[model samples]
Target chain A: GEEVAQTPKHLVRGEGQKAKLYCAPIKGHSYVFWYQQVLKNEFKFLISFQNENVFDETGMPKERFSAKCLPNSPCSLEIQATKLEDSAVYFCASSQSTSGGHNEQFFGPGTRLTVL
Target chain B: AQSVSQHNHHVILSEAASLELGCNYSYGGTVNLFWYVQYPGQHLQLLLKYFSGDPLVKGIKGFEAEFIKSKFSFNLRKPSVQWSDTAEYFCAVRAISSGSARQLTFGSGTQLTVLP
Candidate 1:
């Protein structure tokens, strides 16, 4: 029952512009994750949040990329001053962690960001 | 550091043919593995996962993957793949730890093209 929902299925932005992607995690789920797939290469972890608190963000770009999970509102990953290289499919995932079960992360329809 | 390796970048196969996409990891400890699929214009969905117990796991849509511990591999297989199975598949692994840094690491995906 843990499903992630991402808005803005497609986005076109210019160089130096800003792009914001949104994700609504499954209700009652405590963990949210973001990933970027560039040039159809691989899905790289961008950040992870646990109940509005960042658990790990080492894979995230420090300068231009910032993500936040607001209370009630869905989580958002914002990219300021987007470059050509920043164009990719951004995916959001969520997982519900119990005592002893397979903690499988479910993915959402990605936001395809195209920088022209 | 955890890293995943997928043997094929792109595979073209005929309809109703068997499929075996090779996936391997580079970790020495207890790890969790999963296979995810993304259709041409759809969201990424979980195919199967391996955390504990049986090495062979069955997933949705007649897909199955085997988690071989000694080999550090979790290869996905299907007895008969259809044209609808043409999609990009990702292999992911994460250390089953309670640490804050435990995040799923994905490999460069293998794109399966089932020809009709």
Candidate 2:
């Protein structure tokens, strides 16, 4: 695909339920990133992957949030024990690996998750 | 930690009005700057970026931004804005040093409403 793709444009989960989001990077892109947009304005980086390997997980909440990118599958971000504060729009982005990491990241039509 | 600031929370302008949006980042090292626009009910699209070389970069839809290292600012400008140009604008920055993840740090977006 020429553009990054995200699944389940909208997801609704009750409190304590698990919610999962999927993202497929551009066909030739090697890096995938996930960001959470809260309050419709603030974007917080959650994690990133280099191919199928995790490149960075600094922003991820270790206890309840987990992500994976496996070969031949779309990347997944899972949130266990969903809370009202966890409601947000999850955006997926992909970029080609560059020497200096200055490449432009192509974003997907974010998945809006609503936790009640 | 790198942080970005978008001073204008909301801006209203008449059609064909010249526009300027201010963005500043707090980082001392080499950085890559970018501006992204999100039209209503649409996904985010890259407006322009500043990696290296010239500080002035032009993006789609007659938008341009200038990176000022001295002021730690990347201000977006348009000679004339149309009603269709109404959107939310975000400024993002990524540190260009080794060992830094390729995740972008974005600012709180600015809502630009152009009245025709």
Candidate 3:
């Protein structure tokens, strides 16, 4: 695929319920990133991966938020015990290796999550 | 830590009017700057990026941005805007140092409404 792909255009979850989102990076991309877009369109980085390996997790909430990128599978982001603040649009992006300073990320259609 | 600021929350312009969106970041180190646009009901698309070299970078749809290292700003501009250009614009930055996550830090988006 030429573009990053995301599943579940919209997801509704009750408070304290679990929510999961999936993203498939571009065919040749090696870096995948997740971001949360909250009200007022503020984007917050959640996590990033490099070829199925966790490249950075500093932005992820350790308590309830977890993510994984396994070979031959789409990456997943799961949130346990969802709260009102968790309602947001989750965007996934992929980019080629950033070894020599090229870091252009291609984004996917985000999944809008609503926590009731 | 790096943070981006987009001062204009909303901008309204008539067709054929000039456009400019201000973006600033707070980071002392070298950085990569990018501008992304999201039309209604669509995913984000990269408008332009500045990794190194030229301070002024041009993007698709007649969009251009200037990166001012001294001011830590990357302002997007267009000589004229059309109604089809109505969309949300976001400015992002990534630190270019070792041990950095290389994840983008985005600004609160600016909504552009072009009236015909």
Candidate 4:
């Protein structure tokens, strides 16, 4: 069984401030994914990475949101100038590999972000 | 664009009652389906998944799902649910393709509240 870990289970920030979240995927897992769950309770894909390379970021906000998955460091998702709209629970997920057709993902306990 | 639809937003049931959660996807190509459960204040956990196999798939905690290809649906079912089964259920899908990036599209979750 894979276990994904996330840091700072709760975060509170003021509008216009910066917010950063960290995720450590299961050991040996190469695929990392980020998602945002708003008050509406829907999980929205934000970004995904394969190893140290970004695979898909279609759901990411281009101007203020950025994510990275370095080799030795934990994957990070940062939001510059946080807004009320950015207040949501951010979740991290991981999978072993994407080469095969089927890869089941394991999710981490989400980081709850509250922007005042 | 791929999307998942969960028809039921809230379901209340007594112990020993049958449970069914509807999940439908909007993609025509090959895809992988998943059902996840989120207990109160906990992270999302995989309940079951359907990749490629028999149309009927069984998962942990006496949960099962059926993949109806022609209907483009994967519906979760439990013959008898318990109070501990009260949680939020999410349905997700990922397009299966070699060249495309893999990201899960989750549905608007269904909240199950089981009474003892």
Q: What does candidate 3 score on TM? A: 0.97
Q: Per-residue alpha-carbon lDDT of model 1 for B23-69, expressed as tens digits?
A: 99998888988899988888878899888899999999999999988
Regarding TM-score, does 1 or 2 come out ahead?
2
- Please write out the lDDT profile of model 4 over residues A45-108, one tens digit for every residue: 9999999999988999989999999989999999999999999999999988756667888899
Candidate 1 chain A: worst 10 consecutive residues by lDDT?
A97-106
Candidate 3 lDDT score at position B5: 98
Rate residue A45 of model 2 by lDDT.
99
Clashes of each: 0, 0, 0, 0
lDDT of 3 by residue, A5-110 (tens): 9999999999999999999999988889999999748789999998889998998998999999999999999999999999999999998875686768899999
lDDT of 1 by residue, A1-116 (tens): 35678989999999999999999998888889999989888888999998899989989998999999989999999999999999999999888857664677878888999999
Task: Find the 10 residues in a row with the least total lDDT in model 4 chain A.
Answer: A96-105
Residue B106 of model 3 has an lDDT of 96
Model 1 alpha-carbon drift over 4 Å, by segment: B99-101
Q: Residue B80 of model 3: what lDDT?
A: 99
Cα lDDT tens digits, model 2, A16-103, are: 9999999999998889999999978879999999999999899999899999999999999999999999999999999987665668
